[model samples]
Target chain A: MAKFKVLAAALGILLVLGAAAAQASGVITLEVEILPGFRISGPGSVSFGSLHPGIPEERELQLQVWSNVPWQLSANYYGTVEAPGIVEVQGRNGTWIELGSSTNLVIWDQPKTDPDGVVIKVPLRFTGSFSHDPGTYDIQIEFAVVPLL
Target chain B: MTRVILAMAVLLLVCCGQALASIAVAPVIIEADQVQAGQVFTVVCSHGGEEPLEVALSLALFDQDAWGRVILMEDEASVARAEEALSLERRRFLLQPGQSEAVQVQLAHADFQHLYAVLFLRPVRPGPSTRLAVLFLLSSGEGTPSLDLSGWEQRGTDLTITVENSGLCHGFWAGELLLFDGEGKLAEKVSVQSGVVLPGRSRGLQVSLPGWVQQVEVRSLQLGDGS
Candidate 1:
């Protein structure tokens, strides 16, 4: 009877340990969220903080796009600046263009090779391929889910 | 079954305790809108975490030497003036977790032009304290002194003339160029006639050597873009 009791206790401990381990091993889904109004300021090496009355400041818009789906991504950028300014999307494009200065904000589009209503579309992978200029802008990057159209 | 459940409960409680102490420094941000000439700009430092860190700050000015070399001004005169213009007061006695504080710095005649300063933040207590720090930079109008270079750069029997502008309201104009010789002597003073260079513009004596000269040494030079 004593031997049976000892065996029963040992079996109970083992079951408890197994259950705890299983709980710890459950899936951990990682996430990467975008900050809408990310900005960086400096009397930076360039820009000098003061645009000569008429000179426009060149800026880059960035967004944080992350996920845990282990899948691919496609992003598009669309926006406008108060003044007719030049904007170049880093990583996706190599050139910058001039946009309207007032409410008639300059529009942009990607893959079109030219400005198209201020909207842009880009393709990327799941592993953090954010906009090149990640920390220097005062604009929002609207990331739309580009489905298989 | 009762014994097994008790064992599992104890294990879960211990694991939870470990998770509670795993907090780390999330992120800290410092931002400012604009910095005006001879003015004070407010700076806000923020931390997104569960603990507070002590912050220390300082400021300086950046300029180029005569030879056009990048230099950071930290001499006693400049440093003292800078400290006076910049004032640091803890906006709040407590920097609650996920909170920030505002600091104000005034730009005076002493601290101007490409102002560069650093705001340091480090944990006052020991342990894994999420330290938050940042750098505050402001651009103000250049603080160049208004100097008069009259008969300053000239050499041998040269027509040396001296002209000086000492006030802040008026500056050197295009007609204010002077001619000097190899020696520190004024040769001829030609006032700028066409363009009106204001106080923030260039004004100096123009020296003209009538004959060939071996060497010229310039002195008493008040060289800067503004007053």
Candidate 2:
């Protein structure tokens, strides 16, 4: 009976040590500064000149985003526009989504592609209607890049 | 002659509109422990463009929705609470090309055990502009995190697991999903990316499974201190 008790105690100690080892290996410290740099750049303005009634005009703007961590891109317009227009951004899967007044996700969970940055071309289309007056109208769009924490 | 002049003016405007604005930030995520009054932290912001940039900094509280989308709090009460909790040394500044600034942030109140906020850096220029948002996670070091696997689902070869944190403090969880075959032998293993789960919130994480995977087991679930 004494020998059996000693064996059982030894087994319990081994199990406890094994569990501690596994937990230690799995715990990753969150304090490390892994992503130290993030950058985003684009043109100051895009001009779509002289829109004619019943005609749609298209222009492209290039944006570059660089980061050391996984990040997401979103865009939103500052004010409302009466004209019918669509702002489309190409994704990694070769698809485009319309960006509107509300914040819309353009790129989701994109990994770091380059050290400098990756250029993304955004196509803006404006369709004119006879109901709207002919004048110089400007709509400011803002792009935001945030790390996926 | 007037039409030709106007056309030349428009062409000149388009040619000069190629001004690019670039901004870079370091340490995108800031995690701290035991929040106290007058606690300080630093974030580095740099102007990577050719021209000068007028930068503005603001603070706002944020939360994650069911699909892991960050929603910035805009209500008056939430904004007031955030303002009362944190403050920046310089809210607006000017940065020249290749110039960097160290932003100083000070804590005023420790009203919650765990809090999340974002520091927004925006350029004061017109037209298409790009900005950056940095996340801050602060804790009082008083409570523990209780992470539980709420549920999971499989569709085709994709699997998603929902994890809920019902504790007083926030925590980051990570682990692996073990796949087995019909003979109960281990077929493959898929890693679960580490993500933060705020107090009283749940997060859905997607994992891809092999077609031959008949059984799945979540193993080595570990939670790290996110304060």
Candidate 3:
């Protein structure tokens, strides 16, 4: 009986240790990507806010970007377009919809080089009536990463 | 008694395994949208898991030679001692789990267009070394305008049209501006030069538009005006 009791205690300890080891080794990885000039809008709409001549339009592009891995992520729009009578707008309200308000923003951050990274996709839409003029416009994009909790 | 001894040995092995022969560390993540040149950037590093994790964080910049091969941009002969000898400058940090620490890095003299650095996170524990590659750009705000039609205006009988270069970059090289009427028909077209806007500057020119033209559409020769 004495020997059996000792064996039972030892077995219990072994099981506990095994459980702890398994728990320590479990981990998950995530990834994200964002193409600066890429837009997912529809036909009859030229992205980067250029209004062509004579087309009735209504569409929006929105994105919401966030990081799950203890990182603060954000979107920065540094591009420009110079065509008079054409309206342009962008900001970091966590909501970016080109047309209607509250259309649906996306979570941004998906760089091709970041494997084992978390990706949050945003909705990008475009709608416009080219009732103005036509010309080539300039667009700029810059992405940044901050490592803070 | 024999069974008990065997079980005890097994428990010891399991506990030893839990101690971690090597740690599995994750690379740090940073996100920013378009960093400006000569701007100061603060990066934060956070550790995973509960309880404070002890780690030694190190940073280094890659030095490339004239041929663009990786070389330690410095020589040891300049150092007084081996321990104090440095190839590239390095900064160290101590991070606690669930906590983030920020470090400031400058974008001075570094080409805002091509700048990338490497960050190393070495676990004090016997784990794998995790690393992060950081990239940034500096915008001098000196890019030329893709299209500028500032000189064309509607006058009484004669419309004066001027083609001006209104950008921070250099000249338009060679391009033509075509004017269209409100009816979507081509009206007047002219070539332009001599008006270029330097950084933080602007210029103007003049031209004449037909009396019958109501509204105007300006476009380039590479692809005429219709946005």
Candidate 4:
């Protein structure tokens, strides 16, 4: 009986040690990701206040960009509206600026460090010094963010 | 005596149950669409377990050899230390419980159209590791290769090992070789002649064996996209 008791206690100790070893080796692996993420939001559309023939108009819309890394923003206007005179939109995305038609303009772009929200004034201007047709110009501008990787 | 044994057995089972708990990684693959040079791809790694976790992050390549098997590329020193044109930030972190974190990876350069890279997340504590492969340029419209072993012929105590790669891009294969005698018993097991085969191309490897080789088998252990 004494011998049996000792053997059982030994088995019990072995079992406990084995369980502990297994526990020490158990690890949960989580998927990994790199840094630098951005959430571009605020102001769905850029709207001009009002327009007058032979008169220039300017309006500012707030475009906010939230970034996790160094980033730059660029914009391009689709040539959807075709009306008299010269219709060109001029503005700065954040710092880098391009002044032209059907061209992507680089606004305020350099590099970033953290995920912070920065708002920029996206201005729309229409210079109608020489008017050929007078009407409402419906334009669509697309915005994109480029991060320096 | 019987009671003591029964009690110990029950205690062991209870301990085993508690010891086996683990955390999980979601979307174990990072498949990017039409990625090119200087293109940035983002992936979100969500933690799914009862406890919060901390992990060490690293990169590796996963591949298979002549045999059909999935193996990590870093199992060997050559493939593990091979330089790649890749960039990433935040190498390690302590993730909050039940929270998903985002990681940004950029392909700085690619010698081939398609690239395969695995992001390894090893838990700081005891748990399983997640290997997520980022298949680059899959949107290049070309299909992945179907690598296989073909054309087995014997040459007087030697064997010709051939690998056929049928795809638009190249394939890398490496594994072990198993030799069997005429009696259908295992004879000798040797490391396979591993190498890269070009697309639509077949290459032969000559492996010398020790005795009369009645049967030969290949066990593909690693695989990856080759430039």
Best by DockQ: 2
**Ordering by DockQ:** 2, 3, 1, 4
Model 2, residue A53: C-alpha shift (Å): 5.9
The CAPRI category of model 1 is incorrect
Write down the worst ten-residue block by lDDT for model 2 chain A. Answer: A78-87
Highest lDDT, which number? 2
Q: Which pairs, if any, clash in model 2?
A: B32-B227
In terms of DockQ, which candidate is stronger, 2 or 4?
Answer: 2
- Clash totals in order: 37, 1, 49, 28
Q: What tens-digit string does per-residue lDDT give for candidate 3 at B144-213?
A: 3344444545555354443343343323323455666668787877674422222222333344566666
Question: Against the hidden true structure, what lDDT does model 2 obtain?
Answer: 0.72
In model 4, where do residues sit more than 4 Å from their true spots? A1-149, B1-21, B31-34, B75-83, B126-163, B166-227
Q: Give the number of the best model, judged by TM-score.
A: 2
Interface RMSD of 4: 30.3
For residues B1-227, could you state the per-residue lDDT of candidate 2 as single tens digits? 43322221011011113376778898778888788989987888898778888888877777876656566564577667777888989889999999999888899888778778878788876443566888888988887788777778877778888888888887867778888888999988877844778888898888878788888887647776664
lDDT (C-alpha, whole model) for all candidates: 0.32, 0.72, 0.34, 0.50
DockQ, candidate 2, comes to: 0.19
> Per TM-score, what order, best first?
2, 4, 3, 1
Given candidate 1, what's the lDDT at residue A108?
19
Query: How far in Å is the alpha carbon of B128 misplaced in model 3?
Result: 2.6
Which residue runs does candidate 1 get wrong by more than 4 Å? A1-149, B1-38, B60-81, B91-93, B108-114, B127-139, B142-227
